[model samples]
Target: MAKKQSNYAYIGIAFSLLVFGIIFIPKIVDRVKVGDITRNESRSKKVLTNSDPVVADLMYLEINGVPKKVPPFSFVNQDGDVITNKDYEGKVYLVEFFFTTCGSICPRMNRNLVQIQNTFSDAEDFGVASFTINPEYDTQKVLKAYADNYRMTNPNWHLMTGDKEAIYALANIGFNIYAGENPNVEDGFEHSGNFALIDKNGFMRSRQDDFGNPKIFYKGIISEEEKEDEDGETQEISMLKADIAKLLKEDLVK
Candidate 1:
C-alpha cells in the first residue's frame, strides 16, 4: 500500500507539470520573444519593430473656421537684417514683445526664453522672433547688446525693432498679444508676458487647455522650475518645451 501511494504521488507531480506546461509555456515564450522577460531589455527596439512611437499633436489656433497665421511683417533684427514672416518659413519659432529697458517683467520673460533656447540648442530649424515694444530706444544696437547680455546663442534668434505703430499693431491686432504704453507703470510700458509658438507653415500653434480650448499663448513670466505662480496659474514653460519638440518632430516627417 505504501509503494502504491508513492506511485500515485509521482503521477500527480507529472500531471501538474504537464498542466503548467500546457497553460504557461506559450506565454513565457511570447514574453521572451518580445523582450519583456528581461528588465534591462531595450524598449526602443520593441518600439521600432512592433509599434508606432507616440507623439503629441499641437492645435491650430482658428478664427471664423480659418487657422490664424503669423501676419506678414518685416522688422530689422539685432544684426541689422530684415526679418519677416517669410524668413521664418519652414521653421518652428516663438514670438514675444519686450523692451530692453524694461525694469519689471522683460528680464524674467527673456530669462525663461533663454532657458528654452538652451533646451533646443541643437535644433537648427528652431528660432525666436522678439519684437521690441520700445522701438525708439531698442534699436539694432540695443537689441544686440541685450542679446549678448543674455548669452542668446541661438543663431536664428532675432531681436527686432521697427516702426513703433507697426510693432504695436502687430502685437495688439495681428497676434492679439497685448502691448501698450502706460505712463503710470514703472517701465512706462505694459505688455503681455506671453509667448506664441508658430509652426513651420507660419500658422500660430498651441496646445489646448483643460476644457479643450487652445491655450493660444504660453506664459513666459513663469520659469520652468516653478510649477505655478502667485495667482495659482500653472507654469507653461515645460509645456512649451514639449510642444516645441512636437513641432520640430513634425518638421522631420515632412
Candidate 2:
C-alpha cells in the first residue's frame, strides 16, 4: 500500500509540471522574443510612440482625487547653492535624473533640455531641476563642469547633488522616475529618459493624450528635430515645449 501511494504521488507531481509547461512556457518564450526580459532597461518607463496624438489641456496629475504635488527636497546645485522645492513655488519647471558620466542616454536628454531652455529663454518662470543618480561621483565641481560643457546657461537650470539615498528616493519614490545602479549595464547605472513637468503652485502637470490619459512624462531621449528614435518612438520634445509654454501662461493660485 505504501509503495502504491508513493507511485501516485510521483504521478501527481509529473502532471502538475506538464500543466505548468503547457500554460507558461509559451508566454515566457513570447516575452523573451519581444525583448521584454531586458536587464539593462527600466521596466517602469512608458514608451509613448511619436504617432500618438497630443491634444488636450494641460491637466493636473491626480491620485485618489488629490492633485499630485512635488515632494519636498533640498540639495546643493552645481553652483553650490542650497536649492529646494520652495524655490520653484511660482515657477514652471522640468525634472530629470541623470549622472554626469553616463554615456548612453544622458547626453541626448541634456541636449534636448538645453534646447528647451533656449526656447524658453525669456520665461523667467521656466526652469529645470536635474538631479544626479550617482551622487558619489557627481560632486558640485563635476556638475559645474558638466553644465559648462552642455552650455546649460539658463540660470534656473540647476544640476544638483546631495545624499545618495536622498537623491535615489527623490527619483524612485518622490518623482516616480526610474534611476538605479546595475553593474550589468554599460555605465553601471540605468535611468529612464523621461522628464516630469511641474506647474506653478507645486503640482505635477502634463498634457493629455488622444485617449484622454495624462502622458505623465515626456520622452527625453529624442530631440524635437529627430521626429522619431531608432526604436520608432516619436520625439515628444516639441510637444513638451508647447506644453511648457501653456503652463507658463497659467495664473498662480493666490
Candidate 3:
C-alpha cells in the first residue's frame, strides 16, 4: 500500500509539471511576440529613447522656412561609376542611410523601399538612393553584393559609398540625420534607418522612420490627381500621389 502511494505521488508531480509547461510555454512565446511588435513599432516611429538629441533633431526637418539644400556628395555606385548631385538633378530621390550588415532595422527599411520602388515603377522622375554609413567596410564590392542579394538591379535604385567622414558629415549636417561609428564598438556605424524624400527642386520634403507604421512608409512621394469640377477641390484622395501631383502642377505653373 505504501509502495502504491509513492508511485502515485511521483505520477502526480510529473503530471503537474507537464501541465504547467503546457500552460506557460505559449505565454512565454506570446510575450516574445508582443515584445518584438512593440520594438518594431518604436523603430517605425523613430522614437528611440536611447538615441541622442542630435539624432532626434535630424529626423524631423522643417519644410516651409529656410530652404534646406542636400549638400553635394560624391560616391561610387554599385557599377563603380562616380555619382554626384548632378546625377539626381531634376528627379525625385528617396534617400536612406544604412549599413549592409545591420541585423536589426536595415532589412525592414529595404523591404519598404522596394515596395515604394514597385509602386512608382512607371514614374521615370522617381529614384531611390541608399548610402552606407560604414564606408570603410562597405566598399563598392560589398555594396554591389548587397544590392545583388536584394536583386535591386533597377537603375533608379543607387547604392552608394564614399569616404567615411564624408558620409557621416552628410548624414549629420547636410541631411540632418544622425550617423556615426559606435564609440564602444569597431567596424559598424550606428544610424537611424529613416528615409528622406527630396523633391525635384532640391528640397528635403519628408523624413520617414521606416520601421514605424506602414502609413509613414508611403508618406513621401507625389501621386497622380484626377481632375475635379469647377469647385477646385480634389476628387480622388491619394495623399502621397496628390502631394506629388500638387508639386508637379506648381512646377508647371512656374
Off by over 4 Å in 1: 1-56, 252-254
Per-residue accuracy of model 3 over 1-254 as CA lDDT, tens digit each: 99999999999999999999999888878887777445555664576643423211122245454557678888998889898987877677677888888877687667656655676677777787899987777899999999888877568688999888888888888887778877675445677655666666666653234564122223221222333434563332244444444343323111
**How far off is residue 2 in model 1, in Å?**
55
Q: Which ten residues in a row have the lowest lDDT in candidate 1?
A: 47-56
TM-score (C-alpha) between model 3 and the true structure: 0.59
**Could you tell me which residue pairs clash in candidate 1?**
none
Runs off by more than 4 Å, candidate 3 = 1-64, 183-187, 207-254
Question: Candidate 2: deviation at residue 212, Å?
Answer: 1.6
Scored by Cα lDDT, where does model 1 land?
0.90
Q: Each candidate: how many clashes? A: 0, 1, 5
lDDT agreement with native, every candidate: 0.90, 0.90, 0.67
Each prediction's RMSD to truth:
7.0, 20.0, 22.6
